[model samples]
Target chain A: MMQQEEKLRVSTEQLEGGLGLVAAAGYINNEGGQAIADAVNELVASGCRTILIDLEGTRIINSIGISILLEILDRLMESGGTMAFCNLTPTIARTFEIMGLVQYARIFPDRAAALAALGRDG
Target chain B: MEVALTLPLVPDVELIAARAVQVMGRSLGMTDGELESVTVATVEACLNAMEHGGQTCFFVRVNTHREDGGPSLEVEIEDHGVGFDPQAPPRTSPSRILGCVAKRGWGLTLIRELMDEVDVRSRPGKTVVRMVKHVGGA
Candidate 1:
C-alpha cells in the first residue's frame, strides 16, 4: 500500500531590501499550517521584517489553518514587521474577510502586486 | 446514494472527509459555489467534533436526494464528545470578530453562514451537526 502523501509544502526566499517570501502549496491544514508557521518563524528570526506569502498553489484552508496564520500575523505585528498575502482563491479570500484577517493583513491579486505594494519595483 | 465515513478525530482526517464530500457533491451536479459552501461547512463540523466531541473517532454521512422543489445534499457529522448547547450565541459577533485579534471561534459562524440550513443537537457524550445545501437554486 502506498503511503498517503502530505498535502502542504512551504518554501522561502530572501528577497532584496529585507523582504522575505514564503510560498505555500497544497491544503492548509494542520500539517501545512505548521509548515507555514515554522517557515515564517525562521524568516522573522533572520531579520525579514516584511514578508509576503504567495498562496497561488493553495486552495483549501480550515479554521485551524487560519489560526496558524493568525499566530504568524501576531508575531509580525509585535516586532513592528508586516505580512501580506497574494494570489488567494475566491473562497479563501472570502474566508479571510469573514474571519477578519483582512482587517490586519494586506492582500494583493498576485505576488508582483504584493511586491510592488511592499515598495519593490519588480 | 449515501456514503458514510468514520475517521479519527484528527485535523488532517477532516480534509479527507471534506474532499470526499466535495467529490460527491460534484457528481450530483452541484455548482462550484454551492460545493464550496458545503465543503467549508463540513470541515467546520468535523473540526468541532474533534475539538469538543471528546471522542477519538467521528462519523460523517453524505446523502443526496431530490426534494419536491429540487435536488439537495445533506451532510451529518457526529462525535461522541462532551457536547455543549447547540443554540448558544456565537462567542463573538461580527464587530468583535473584526476588531479582536484572535483567530479562533469562527468555525461555527462560518458553518451557519455558508450552509443553507443547519441543525445542531448536542448533549453529554454526543454531538451531531447536520447541514443541507440546495443544488442549483433548489
Candidate 2:
C-alpha cells in the first residue's frame, strides 16, 4: 500500500480488459482525496475504463473529499470511463446520498458486487 | 466538559477537529456511528470555514448537552470572514440531474444531514455553525 498521507493509504490492482481496483484505507481527507484522484487518473491513462474503489478499510470521508471524487467521476464519465465504490460506512453512505453522489456513482456492498457491476460496464 | 480548538486554515487540518470530536464523543459514550457522523460533520464545517471564510484560522467548540430525550454533543464552528445566507439556494449545485454537483456547496448540506440539530448564523464578517448529535438509545 502506498501511503497517501500520514492518515491515508492507497493501493491499486489492475485487471484484464480495462478494469482496475484501488483499495484505500484511513481518512479520505484533502490530501487523501488528491492522492486517490492521481491514482485514478493514472489508471485511466493506462486504459482502464471501469474502476472500483474498495473502501473496506476506510470509514471517514469529508465533503471536500466527496467533492474531489465528484470531479474524478465527471472526468471519467467524459472519457467513457466510470467509477464505483464498495464497503462505505453507513454514515458515509448516508452523506453520499445527502450529497447526491450516489446518483452517479454506483456503491455496492463489497468488492464482489462492485466488480459485478463494473464487469457489466466493461 | 467542553473542548475548544483554534484551527489553522490549512489543508487536512480539519482532521484535528475530527479527531477531537472522536475523543469527545467517545467520552460521552456515543456509538461508533454517532461518532463517525459527528466527525464527518465537523470536518465539513471546518472545511467550509477554511475555504470560504476569509480568516487565517477558525474556532471549534465541543460540549456535551442534555436534551429532553437524551444526551447529546454539540459542535460549534466559528469563522470571521465573509458570511453567507444559509437560506439561499445552492449557488451552483446543479439541478439534481444525477450528474455533477458543481464541485462545491455540499459541505453545509452534509453537515445538516448528519447532525440532529443544526443552526447557522452569519453576517458580513462572522459565521457560526452549531450542530448537535444525540447519543442515541434515548
Candidate 3:
C-alpha cells in the first residue's frame, strides 16, 4: 500500500500590517478535512477578513474537503470578506475549476500575488 | 430473487455492499460497467450507514426481481441505533466528530442518482435505507 503522507499544518504571520497569513500544507481527505476546517475557522475567528489560504503544500482533496472549502467561501461571502488560494497543484487546480469554485474565488500563483491582491503586506 | 446478509457495522460494511450489488446485478443481467457503478454506489451507502448509524450490528436485504420483464433490484440496509434526521441538510463545514477533511455531502445524492429509487427512514432506534436500481433503463 502507498504510505499516507503527513496531512496538514497551519501557521499565522503578520502581513500588510493588518492582514494575517494562514498557510496550509498536505492532502485534504476524510482524514484531514476536519483539521483544515478548524484552521480556517480559527483564522476567521481571529478577525482576519482578507484570508489567504496558501495551498502550495497541499496535494489531494476529496469531496469532503471540497465541501469544507465551499462552506468557508460561503461564510466569507456572507460576511463580505475575501479568501484567496495560492500555489494549487494541478490535480487540485483542476478540481477547483470543475467545481466552478474559481468563478467566485481568486487564485494566485504564489504568496506575493495573493497578498498583493488582498492588499496586505507580506 | 432475494438475498439476506448480515454485516458488522464496522469498516467491513463495504464488503456487504459489494456482495449485495453483485448478487442483485447478476440476477438482473446487468453489464459489467453497470454493475460496477451499482457496486460503488452501494458501498457508499453502506459507509453512510456505518457513519450515521451508531449501532453495533447491521443488516442488508437485497430483493431482486423482474418488473415488466426488466431486471430490478432493491436493497434495504437496516441498523439498530439512534438514528439522525436524513432530511436535514448536511453540515457545510467539516465536522469535528467525523474527523474528515474533504467536505462534499454528496453520498446520498450519489446513491440516489445512481439508483432508480431511494427511500430512507430514521426511527427512534433504527434506521433503514431502501435503494432500487433498474437494469437496461427499463
- Candidate No. with top TM-score: 2
List pairs with backbone clashes in candidate 2.
none
- Model 3 sits at a Cα RMSD from the real structure of 9.2
Residues B81-134, candidate 2, lDDT per residue (tens digit)? 999899975433345533635666778777777889899999989999999999
Candidate 3 residue B7 Cα shift, in angstroms, is 0.9
Q: What is the lDDT of residue A75 in candidate 3?
A: 75
**After aligning candidate 1 to the native by TM-score, how far in Å is the CA of B137 from where it should be?**
3.9
Between prediction 1 and prediction 3, which has the larger TM-score? Answer: 1
- Give all TM-scores, in the order shown: 0.88, 0.89, 0.50
Ranking by DockQ: 2, 1, 3
lDDT of each: 0.81, 0.83, 0.67
Instruction: Order the candidates by TM-score, highest first.
Output: 2, 1, 3
Please tell me the TM-score of chain A for candidate 2.
Answer: 0.90
Clashes of each: 2, 0, 13
For model 1, chain A alone compared with the true chain A gives a TM-score of: 0.91
Steric clash count of candidate 1: 2
How does the DockQ of candidate 3 come out?
0.10
Give RMSD to native, each candidate: 2.9, 3.0, 9.2
